[model samples]
Target: MTHQEPPRGRRIPGIALRHRWISSVMVAVAQLIGTNGAARNQSGRVHLDALAYVLLLAGPALLPLRHRLPVLVAAGTTTVAAVYLALGYPYGPVFLSVIVAFFTAIGAGHRRAVLIIAGTVYTVEQLLVGHWLYRWLPPAGDGPTSWMTTSGIAAWLLAVLAGAELFRSRSERVARERRERAEAESRRAGEERLRIARELHDVLAHSISVINVQAGVALALMDEHPEQARTALTTIKAASKEALGEVRQVLSTLRAPGDAPRSPAPGLDRLPELAEQAAGAGLKVDLSTVGARFPLPPGADLAAFRIIQEALTNIVRHSASRTARVRLGYGPEGVELSVDDDGPSSPRAEPAVSGGNGLVGMRERAAALGGTVEAGPRPDGGFRVLAKLPTGAAGTVAVATEEEGR
Candidate 1:
């Protein structure tokens, strides 16, 4: 069997000592009553006098084990008291031990057993002892109950209440600490995930943007200048290397503690690179605008950058055609980004199907910035992604266009 340690507050040596001292006082009082200021028992039994004192002193030693063995302590006290009574000793200290035992039982969370044992002890003690006192004296005339009787009942009630309060306070403290730890862990996890997402966005946006630009140049030279086409390919290689370096920097930052500052995070300002990279990747990303450019929210720039990055990535991964279009329009209110591809010439072309995390990530990103994203295949044989972020201003004008200026 496994033994669980009690809580720290409950484990203090002082608390056990406190219980022991209280038990010792009770036992001493009982011994004093039994001895009645004399060295011999009522029957002049000197051995009984010595025995009672020894047993009373021993009672305190059992206090340390009160919580661990409440029932046993109660039973032992009852047995010893029975012996003391049979030997014609006074009932004072034995009464106190019984009261203390009742409390120990309650403190141990064995209230049901305490009730049963208390009832049985009260019945046996009263029957064997109470009747004798009653027989010797008629009903009391104007006397507050005996000191032992009144105090024992009051002490038992107070101990049970005190024990319950101690248990409640301990429970609340533990629950509060557990909740704090859980919240701290959750916050840490959220920060780590955000950091990773930012790094991946940076790597992907930089690489794809370079590829789009090179592909555009290559297409421009395809028929008239084969050598120029090769040059554009070389440019693509350089861009890819630069992207790899940036990605490595990001990964390094994630793994190690460093003071090296990172380049500016990707945002709306990097749209040109994104469009150029998509063009290099064989997608003609046409970007145009309407309305005056105004300062966007802190997250707007990054949101714009991500929408375009994912759109271009989708183009590269899904479309078979050599042409795609991208548009970004700044309205009086918010900005809108839309990317569309012409219907693929081959029906066998597979569309990009994110295992779901990508879309969820995108949606989460957009929603966090008070924006929305919609993506689906166009009936006319293409795919489109549109994102709208409300600038929370009235000046924003949204626009949408595709094939036939649709």
Candidate 2:
């Protein structure tokens, strides 16, 4: 149906014009051989002459252009075949070439056109050739064709169109399936890229915020407070080192899939390290645990850790408050995390950078795990981020690990 390229299994299993040429020549030769053989029995019919040969071969001659112009070729071939039959030449393999043209036309999505032409051509043959003009033609004394013979020919025409229509439906279905598969693969690829991007942003945003604060401290105290300046430089070195190590951990999974991670992903158990890091950046973070503690599923563990990490990083970058609070609660089906910072947003720090994913990233991480995140300014003059992550799914960790490898 598509004009962009020659279709497969239309006329034949090929797209090149040369294949059409070969097929046309083969059909012409077969028709010539079979018609000559049929002439031995049908001596009452018109004799084969030069014009008879030309008209007999005309249908196959037009076969080469069927893919590009099927409707015209189908109509032309059916007309030529009808004329050959009307001349009262013994009917044998003379219909072969036109049959090939009919299939080609139908396959190229011109079934309606081909069916109309074929029906019209058959009507003319039955009227003038088989009934009305047989006496005037060279096949003298020939009367109208028998009712049985007319019915059989009509059935044959129906069979050809029906067979072509069936094949067309099958090819259309296969094409549709292939398109769906391609679209699915494209969608999966996009999701994988976004997941990896979120991982990188979560890993870098916190450490970078720490490094920035420490860098400012070291610059201001270089001369007057050399001892404090040294402490600030030490914190910078530690933060950069940890950032690089975690970045390598993420990249290693990419280079070698299905292998053990160089180190396990950080979980909420590492909250003390976060507190120490916040303290180094001059923010006193208080951590609390509620309900009972249990090892969370890997998906929930990673999501909970990142949500809290991002919340703390946001406080360090956006909130003027010197103290932040974090509460982790474990329920039977899921874990809840709440991070809070007191006071209005910082003029010295910065807003969640112009186009950055801060709270949005937290929400995405939670939603991926069949959970939700809610963040807003509290009525008590502070900002709070709350997330709930379900841990009931099996193999959540393996799926996340495999995606990073890709």
Candidate 3:
């Protein structure tokens, strides 16, 4: 059998729920003891009276309402205790209920000024009533005015106030921590969702662009050039298959309860495949490396590859460019990547759709790794994109040597 926790605001069986009954029983016991002693008086036995019994039990009986009406309950209980003491009744644990109510008031978020007022009123009432009671029926010894009695009373009151304040502060701190943790979790979830969206956009956009171009080519040559159309169809099949695999990989990461073997993300090693895809789409891509190559951090590597892919995809879709060049340069500080296309500049040369997110995604990826990207129409003609990424100490000796040479 599974036991589910009750929702918030539902009452649970615990100390708080039983506090009233427990307090009532304690007050009854104290009253019984004090009354028994009063009855043993040799001068005259103090008889039990209905009004005295009612006043003595009033404070304890009201303990259960402390949580709902803390300040009011505290004031009520304190008044009852003061009146009971003033009536020349035997003093006992009547003040226990007041202390509990004070704690409830503090926990309920009563202000410092209100607490001060309550404390002052309660102290003054107790002092006035105790003095009158002492004069009316002097104790057998030093009485409540004795140093020990005064010090003990002061210490008990201070202890109750200090304990209540400490608990209030602690509860507030715990609530603040819980809220902070929830906000942090919310931010992490948002970032994860954005990462997934970026991955899907990159995968789908590039593959679909390639397939779209290949499908167009196949349709254009279906009758006149059957062999080339078949090749175009093959390219479409390959691009779609690759896109499906990448999409599945992204989805698998989100799946719970399964430990599927994870695939390493694409990086610079996939540049040749990207070039081949561009070539199949009728764009000649020439890739070159400079200053040697070094291993990059996983995130940096993926970001670099995606930036290059998005740049090339844009060229295929928007620029009327038939040829493009990709250059990779490594240095101790970071890796630099640039893509230049020899596309014709025309009013219709830009992407079919306005305000595409390709550049935004590229910039976001690079900026996340302390890198930057620049893209604009070339001074002479066509368009160009350049990106610089920071690699830190993880960069290999090739990068260091290249930097030294520079």
Candidate 4:
């Protein structure tokens, strides 16, 4: 789906200048033969006939320049032939130059001019050869068969013209479609980069800010509450480390040349770790699972993880609730993840310090996976976050608890 420009001065394979040269030589020979025979019959002398044939052959050399200056070449050759006709000379192969010119005009996207010139030249040639001049100096034929012969020549010329028009139209349409497709792809890539940038800013910024606050709290309490300070320091270290990993993962997408690429991204299997981390940050995160244990797509996993992480962070910072629940359920059609906190449920504007990037990032992620997400307060005095993602197949598996008859 990519186009590479060819090197300068390199000719395309089928359209080489050599083919034009060969065609010009062949057409010249054909003109020589046609004129030689016709002039001999018309003038009844060998010397004068040879001169006419030479003049006709001279016209065909113009064909080699048709690709560069099609209209000029056609006009010049046709002018020469028109003069020859006035002198009562024979029909010549130089007429082929008009066909070559029409072909070039069509290919070069000048169809209107090509049609006008083709119609004028063809009409003039028909009038001169078919009726007017034929009555005065007709070819050696006794029947209507001569008329058929002349008509056939005109039809063949028109057919070549039609073929050239078809080729040019199709080529132009294909080129237009290719350009449109490339533009669409460019727009999609730009949108994707913007989405990635927003996610990195939302996720890493929020995590690092939390880590910084915890570190500051630990420092402030070190001399007073040793045990509490130790816990705060531990949470600070863990948050900072996780922030570094998230930042590195985001930055890894922009790895420079010569850097070894990282492993494939995480998926749903890491959701439990995310819940555990939220619990460590002084939130009681209860985890639950339902249905199958089938593998989830990488995109689905990352989206689910980010959704849970944001929901927990919101609960930690905004709600007075100490307990949050994370739920995962796989079913016959799709997978679903939901987080709920039985905390202060009164609706309020999102914290000014963090903005609303978390909600935007979550919506963007879900949309990319062809999934759905909803975040709102429940009727039962709690906040809720829910997401549903389609799975390729339905599956079944055993579910286990941390201490099941151990």
The lDDT for every candidate, in the order shown, is 0.65, 0.85, 0.79, 0.70
Model 4 whole-model lDDT (C-alpha atoms): 0.70
Name the candidate, 2 or 3, with the larger lDDT value: 2
> Compared to the true structure, candidate 2 yields what TM-score?
0.80
Question: lDDT tens string, model 3, 1-406?
Answer: 9999788645676856686677667866676566556655623323446877887678778877777778788788878876765555555666777777778788779847336755676566456544445555533332444556555777777787888888889989998998899899899888888888899999998999899899989999999999999999999999999999999988887884266527888999999999999999888999998876888998999999999999998888888878999999888788999999976753444434544688888888989999999988898888999999998886666666766788
| Collision count of model 4 | 0
Clashing pairs in 4: none
TM-score of each: 0.58, 0.80, 0.82, 0.70
Best by TM-score, which number?
A: 3
Please give the ranking of all candidate structures by TM-score, highest first, separated by commas. Answer: 3, 2, 4, 1
lDDT for model 3 comes to 0.79
How well is each residue in 317-405 modelled by candidate 2, as lDDT tens digits? 98989999999876656678899999678899774555468777888889888999998889878999999888763335534554577
Q: For candidate 4, write residues 1-406 as lDDT tens digits.
A: 9999888647786677789889988888877776566555654322445556656766777888888887777677766665555445554454665666666778887777776766676666566555665444433441222567668866877797798898888878997898888899899878868766865765675576466556666887889998888988787777778777766776776675246536445566766666666666557888898865666666677777777787787786677787999898877556888999997832432454443777777888888788888988899888999988875543222223212424
Ranking 3 against 4 by TM-score, winner: 3
Rank by lDDT (best first): 2, 3, 4, 1
lDDT for position 317 in model 1: 58
